[model samples]
Target: MVIRVRDLVKRYGNLTALDHLDLDVQAGEIFGLLGPNGSGKTTAIHCILSLLTFEQGTIDVFDCEMTPDAYELKQNIGVVMQNVAVFDELTVYDNIDYFCGLYISDKAKRKQLVQEAIDLVALNDFVKFYPKKLSGGLLRRLNIACGIAHQPRLIIMDEPTVAVDPQSRNNILEGIKKLNQAGATILYTSHYMEEVEQICSRIMILDKGRVIRTGTKEELKATISLGEKITIEVENLPSHILENIKTNPHIATFDYDDHVLVARFIRGENGLVDLLELMNSSHLQLGRVYSELPTLNDVFLELTGKELRD
Candidate 1:
């Protein structure tokens, strides 16, 4: 394991931030740690990096016990937090070079690494631009470049795509894949389900400082009571067709509103075919039909109730 967190616990006076959380991340895999706001995602990260002192348990990085002053281990780890940490006064090149210099002291090697990070984030054109001059997306890219410029083997990115343009989001995701391909193990945390689904090889969803589910996306989905969700749009959904779909054993629940029939199937082998056949036999004109498998969001909602968790 590249990172192992066992029985990890953190407390802030009376509130428990991490409730004996157990986590493991393998080498060369993009692992996603997903949760809602204040679900202990940040706490777990802080504990792992030794930034905040945890109440109990052990955190191991690079197959050894981690320490706050583990400079050798820290050198191999790169962290890009949710907040932008680059200096507003510094240009893009300077920001990246400064962070890279922390790990690599040799001027010749540091220059090459810094330039590579700039190229990786596609910031070549904006190397001289300060943070204030850049758009939200460009600023995010620069933040990433600063973190990964040192070419750390382990990269931890916390909500790196928050409030960024779609194009920059795509660039960041692609850059992450390239980094993993080049042998960097990444721990990515985000509230965006699709981003985690797109990039992570394995996912762990937490709620209220505890892990609810952890597995490959397929594995996690298999554990849930939700299967495929079929959506069909029609000119007008008849009451009979809606009732029939709702009454079907394969389907768990259905919603009909504004000429759209949405059926959620908890379990079934041929849900798609069965749904289509029923709709066609009932003389319901299907304008658009889409069948989607259970997503990471569904799994999270299932494990943690829809009720709000602080």
Candidate 2:
């Protein structure tokens, strides 16, 4: 295991932040950490990294117990947090060089590693540009480059794509996949569900400082009763028909908005067909009919309850 935590417990004053959370991260896989705001995701990560004091539990990294002074183990770990950390006085090249120098002392080795990091993040064109001069996307790439300059075996990325453009987001995600393929284990945390579904090999969802569920995207979807969502684009759905859809025994829930009528079914076969048939029998005109399988978002909502969090 790249990282292992057993009976992890953390508290803040009177409130318990982590309630004996247990977690394991395998080697050479992109593991996703997901939770709503204030779910103790950050607290758990801080505890695992040995940056914060915990009330109870064990944290092991690279087959050795993790501690604040584990410099050897810490040397092999790279972290790119949500907040951008870079030297405003330094250019892109110098920033990566400074970070790489922390883990490497030989000048020649540091130069090579810095260059590789720059190339990996595709920041060759902006090497001489100061951080303040770069765009939001470019700055994000630079942040990643600095974290990875040492070629760490385990990378922890927390919201690296936040507030970046779509193109930059794709580039960052692709670079992360390449890194994983090249033998680095990744612990990725993101608010975007689609990104997690797209690249994560395994996913863990947390709530109230405890693990709600952990599995692959397919496995997570299977855990919920929601099977498929059928949508029909129809204008002006009548109140009677909307009420009738709510009466469906097989349907878990449904809604209509903006010429779109969406129905969610619970492990039902031919749900789309039945919904379409019902629409036809009601003399409703359909513009577009689409069927989609359950997604990670659906699993999250089902397990955590469909209520907005603060």
Cα lDDT tens digits for candidate 2, 1-310: 9999999999999899999999899999899988777777778878878889999999999989999999999999998878899999999999999999999999999999999889888999999999999999999999999998899999999889989999999999999998999899999987678899999999998888889899998889889898888888998888888887899888888888888988888964457777778788889888988889988778888898853132
lDDT of prediction 2? 0.88
All candidates' TM-scores? 0.95, 0.93
CA-lDDT, candidates in order: 0.89, 0.88
RMSD of candidate 2 to the truth, in angstroms, is: 2.0
lDDT of 1 by residue, 55-158 (tens): 89999999988998899899999999998999998999999998988899999999999999999999999999999999999999999999999889999998
lDDT minimum window of 10 residues, candidate 1: 301-310
Report the error of model 1 at residue 111, Å: 0.6
